[model samples]
Target: MQIGSIQLAPGAALAPMAGFTDAACRRMAARHGAVYTVSEMVSAKALTFGDKKSAQLIANGETLAPYGVQLFGAEPETMERAAALIGGYAFDFIDINMGCPAPKITAGGAGSRLLLEPERCGAIVAAVVKESGGRPVTVKMRTGWDAQHITAAEAAKACEAAGAAAIAVHGRTREQMYTPGTVDPAAIAAVKAAVKVPVVANGDIESAQDALDLLEATGCDGVMVGRAALGDPWLFGEIRAALAGQPLPPRPTLRQKMEALRTQIYEMCEEKGEWTAMPQARSQALYYMKGLKGAAALRRACCELQHFEDVDRLIEKVYAAGNR
Candidate 1:
């Protein structure tokens, strides 16, 4: 699939999930076979003001290419400045965040709130594209603000008109949040039909079959995997295999999962120091241990540890449990 001139191999993409799609996670996902991965959303206003943390979030990872950076804000000037600054960096694409439903973001007139202001959304896209200097500009958005306002089709058209290289549609309204239900495939297909650019479908794609079903239902160019990628970076490889008409590989054993977790934590420690990385690994460690027989005990033990060595030891203990 091609977003603008950027060609992405068929299969899975790592959705830009907050707190989970950091540099370490992106590198791991890429290494495990994700064709593309996006950085966590950064604040456009903060980036324009030179916020160090926001700038740091957009830093390039050595092993992760086709790096996409997502930025959020209401003001066109702020979005434009952010696009200009990021254009000078080593990013592969710039994505405007129009899908975030967080109240704080909406209260600030940003994120999914842009759905209500299509004209301003178009202007912001135009400003970012102009400042991008030919770098591909993409938009991630929701179905609408609510059931009464299904604006994704219109927003997709507006984004395409404003020069968006691609669009990712999450088939749920801001009010739906993350509820469990059937995604609106018609809404996604409508957006795909409304746009000239490639459209990527997102939402509830947790398995290889789910990916295939979404692609078929929406007639989308690609699928982005979010929560499902959480302890399972190998999901991308599985999706890739499925798309190639190959047999799916066997699921990893608990021992293998623990080993992967250990390797991930060690690599993160090497990159960010034990002090910083150990704490960051807590949630991921829980994710890795999720389905194990004694997972609750293991998660508690791992989460209580303050050092990499402790994490390694806990993983070793878990691995000793065998297939049970």
Candidate 2:
């Protein structure tokens, strides 16, 4: 598959998730077989002013190549300026975030709120495309602000006209806020039918069956793995295998899972200081540790970890437990 000028393998891609999907997390996802990954949501205002923290959010930490950075904002000018500033970066695409439902973002008239005004959303996409030098522009958005709005089909057409290379639609309204049982696959189908660009379906996809069902149901170009991939990057491999009609890979052993978690911890440490990285790594490690024997105790120990060595100690403890 291709996103405008960028070439991509035809399979599952990692969704840009905030508080997750950072450089280390993206690496983890890629290592496990996700064909693509998008950086966490970045503030256009911060990038426009050269904010170091925001810049770090999009920095290419790996030479692995082909990752995209997602930017969020409502104003066309500021969005264009932000894209222009980062146009020379090594990323493969500049993705616009029009689907975030967080109050912090929607209150600012960014994210999913953009669906409320389809025309303006198109203009923002056009501005970013114009200022992004030759980089392809993409978008990720929800079905709409609410059931009453249900405007993803309309917004999708606008994005296509504005030159978006592809669009990803999360099948929920802002009112659902990711609540289970609220995803409407029909909405994803609507967006796909309304656009020529690739449309990726996202929302409550937990297993290979779910991914396959969404693909056959909506006929979307691709599927994005979101929260379901937390601590479990292996989902991508499983999804990829399922897409290919191949046998699913075996589930990872506990020691192997711990090692992957260790790799993630070190990656985070290299990107951020131990203090900052530990908290972030611990959270992700907890996800990895979920459902394990003595996982609760191990998680508490992870909470107090102040150094990298602590992670090793926890790994050993997990190894010795052996389901005891």
Candidate 3:
């Protein structure tokens, strides 16, 4: 699948998850064969105002090429400025975040709130395109504000008309949050049919079969995986293999999973410093151990650890026990 000049080998793309899709995680996903990986959403206002933290979040583009930076804001000018500022950098694509259902974002009339004002959304897309200087611009959107306002198709059309290179449709209304039974394949199909640009289907794609089912059901050009990617970076490789009609690889052994978790935590500490990385590592370590025997006890140990050595020791003990 090609988005502008960037060509992605057909498979899964990583959703721009906040507080999680950082440089190390994105690079891991890319290395595991995720066709594309987006940076966590950065504030348009923060980018324009030269907020150091927001700028840092978008700084490491070389690590994940075909990299996309997702930005959010309601104002066209701020969004335009952010596009220009970020475009001047080495990013492969710029994505407008219109799917975020967070109340803070919606209260500011950004994110999914833009769906209710398609005209304004179009204007924002147009401004970002002009600022992007030929780099591809994409939009990620939810099904709609609610069931009463299933406007993804309409908003998708407006975005395409305003120069978006692609559209990613999450198959749920803003009101659905992350609930099961909320993902409507028909809504994804509607958005795909409404535009000539590529449509990437998202939502509830937790396994290789789910990814295949989403593509077959929606006829979308690609699929994006979000929550499922947590603790499971190899999912991209699985999806890639599935799309190529290959047999699935055996699940990682407990020891292998522990090794991957140790590597990820070490890298996070190296990149973000020990103090800042530990809390996040604790959360991720727990995610990595999900479904394992004695996981609750292991998670508590991980959460209380003060240093990387402690993490390494915990992982060693867990693997030894699993082997026994």
Candidate 4:
């Protein structure tokens, strides 16, 4: 699939997930086969104010080409200014985030709240595009504010008309907020039909078949994997194989899974010191334990991780559990 001039060979991309799709994670996804990857959302307002942390989030030294920097904010001028500032950075495109359903984001009238005003959504996209140094600008958004306000089609049209290169629709209203089993492919199909730009579908895709089914159901250009890919970067390889009519690769063995987790943790440690990365590694480690035997106990151990030696010890315990 192609977004503007950027050609993505695989039909899958990694979704921008805050606190999750940092450099280490994006690099892992790329190594596995995600055709495109986006950085965690960076606040446009914060970047304009010289927020170093938000600025740091846009760094993509570890991820491969076709990577995008995602920016979130409600103000058009601020987003425009942020785009200008980002012109010096290396990225394939600019992604505007309007799908985040977190209360802190919505409370500030950004994220999913932008869906409440279709015109404002168009304005923001246009503003960013104008200052994007000729780079394509994309938008990620939800179906709407709520079931009663299913406005994805209308909003998508407005964005496309205002120079958006592509649109990614998370198939749930803001009210749904990641609730399982609530993905509305019909809403995504409407957006695809309403716009000429490529549209990517996201939500509840946990397996390769799920990715294929969503593409068929919504007629979207591609699929974006989110939380499901947290501990399983290989999911991208599976999706790529499925997309290309190739046999799926064997699932990672328990030892292999443990090694991948450790590699990711050490990479995180390299980027942010072990002390800082270990605390965050706690949750990441738990994701790798999903579906393991004695998962509850393993998770308890994962939560206590505070140092590199602790991770090695946990790996030993996980192996002792004989999880397949």
Candidate 5:
């Protein structure tokens, strides 16, 4: 699959999850087999104003090739400026985040709130595309702001008309934020039917089967995995296998899981320092430790962990126990 100048492998793509799909996590996902990864959503206004932190979010950090940088904003001018600025960065494409369900974003008439104004969304996409310097621009959006406003098909048409190369649709409206099993595959299907550009299905795809099911049901060209990838980057390879009609890959061995966990920890620390990275590292560790022997105790231990040295010793014990 191609997005502008970059060619993506045919498989699962990593969702641009804030606070999670950072550089370190994207690198891990790329190594494990994601076709492409998107950086966490950077604020367009911040980028326009030259916010160093937000601009830094687009910098390459061992992320695999074919990566995009996602941006969120309500204004066309700011979004266009941000897109133009990032065109010179290391990203392969530019993604507009019209799907984030967070209240802080939607309340400001950004994110999924863009669903309430399809024309304006199109204008924003058009301006960004024009300013993107011929880079492929994409859009990620939910079905609508709420059940009462199911506009994904309309939005998809708008995005395409405005020059988006591809659009990804999440199955839920903002009203169903993060609710399990609420994703409407029909909505994604409708979007695929409405647009000539490639459409990607995104929602609660947690397994290889989920990805295959989505592709079959929606006829989407791609699938974007979100929360399911927490500490489970290998899901992309498994999804690729399922799509190719191959047997599901084996689950990670105890040692392999431990090693992956350690690598994520060290990478997080390396990128964000030990002090600030620990809190989220603890959360990620719990996901890796899920369903393991003595997981309850181990989760509690991780929750209480404050120091990397302490975490290493505890992980060693957990690894030894699981091996036994």
Candidate 6:
């Protein structure tokens, strides 16, 4: 799938998760075969207001090419101004976030709430596209506001007509809120059928088989992995290999996984300083402990982490628990 000049071979991307898909996590996914990665969502209104934290979110710190910064807002003028402000950055494109289902985001009439008004969705897309510095403008959106609406097909068509270079459909309504087992691939398929632009399917894809299943179900040009890539960024490589009809790569050993996790955490510390990054690392560490024996105890340790030494101590406990 090619968006403008960006060639996303294998059609795999790292979805723009609010706090999780930061620069460090994005770099890890890129190294493992994610062809595209978007920065965490930034508030268009905040950027327009000169919010320092919002400015920091779109910082071009990662070395990966074809990177993008995602922005969210209800007002077309605010989104247009925000896109123009970040035009100096080295982003290949600007992605409009219309899929976030968080209460705070939806309450502001942005994110998935935009799905309720397809015309407004088109206006917002057109506004951003007009100021995108000649770069392609893309959109990430949900199936609809709720099951009763199911308006993804209509919204996607509006976005395409308004100059969205591509579209990513998360296969659930705002009401689902990432609930387990609620993904509706049929909704994603609807969006794919409605848009001429490249369409990417997202939601509930954890394994290579899940990725293949979504592709078959939606006929989407790409798959975007979110939470599953937190500790296991290598899932992208596995999906890529599966799509290429090649043997899957061997799963990393426990020690290798630990090293990978360390790389991710340490990079975060370097980028944002230990003080600010460690608190976030607590949840990130828990993602790595998923499905392991004594995970309950490991998660307890993860929650108390406060510094690099704490992470080191936790690693020792993990090794002991794994009998490695």
Worst 10 residues of 2 by lDDT: 315-324
Model 5 residue 290 CA deviation in Å = 1.3
Off by over 4 Å in 1: 320-324
Rank the models by lDDT, top first.
4, 6, 2, 3, 5, 1
Model 4 worst lDDT window (10 residues):
56-65
Query: Highest lDDT among the candidates is held by which one?
Result: 4
Model 6: how far is 244 from its true place, Å?
0.3
The residue pairs that clash in candidate 5, if any, are none
lDDT of 6 by residue, 29-140 (tens): 8988898999999999999999988887887675674788999999999999999999888778999999888889989999999999999999999999999989999999
Task: Report RMSD for candidate 2.
Answer: 1.4
lDDT of 3: 0.88
**TM-score of model 5 vs. true structure:** 0.95
Return the number of clashes found in candidate 6: 0
lDDT by candidate, in order shown: 0.86, 0.88, 0.88, 0.91, 0.86, 0.90
Q: Relative to the unseen true structure, what is the C-alpha lDDT of residue 268 in candidate 1, on a scale of 0 to 100?
A: 73
When 1 and 6 are scored with lDDT, the better candidate is: 6
Residue 36 of candidate 5: its Cα lDDT? 83
Residue 246 of model 1 has an lDDT of 93
Error of 1 at 240 (Å): 0.9
Clashing pairs in 3: none
Q: TM-score, each model? A: 0.95, 0.96, 0.96, 0.97, 0.95, 0.97
* Model 6, residue 86: C-alpha shift (Å): 0.8
* Cα RMSD for candidates in order: 1.6, 1.4, 1.5, 1.1, 1.6, 1.1
Error of 6 at 194 (Å): 0.6
lDDT at position 250, candidate 6:
96
The Cα error of candidate 6 at residue 254, in Å, is: 0.8
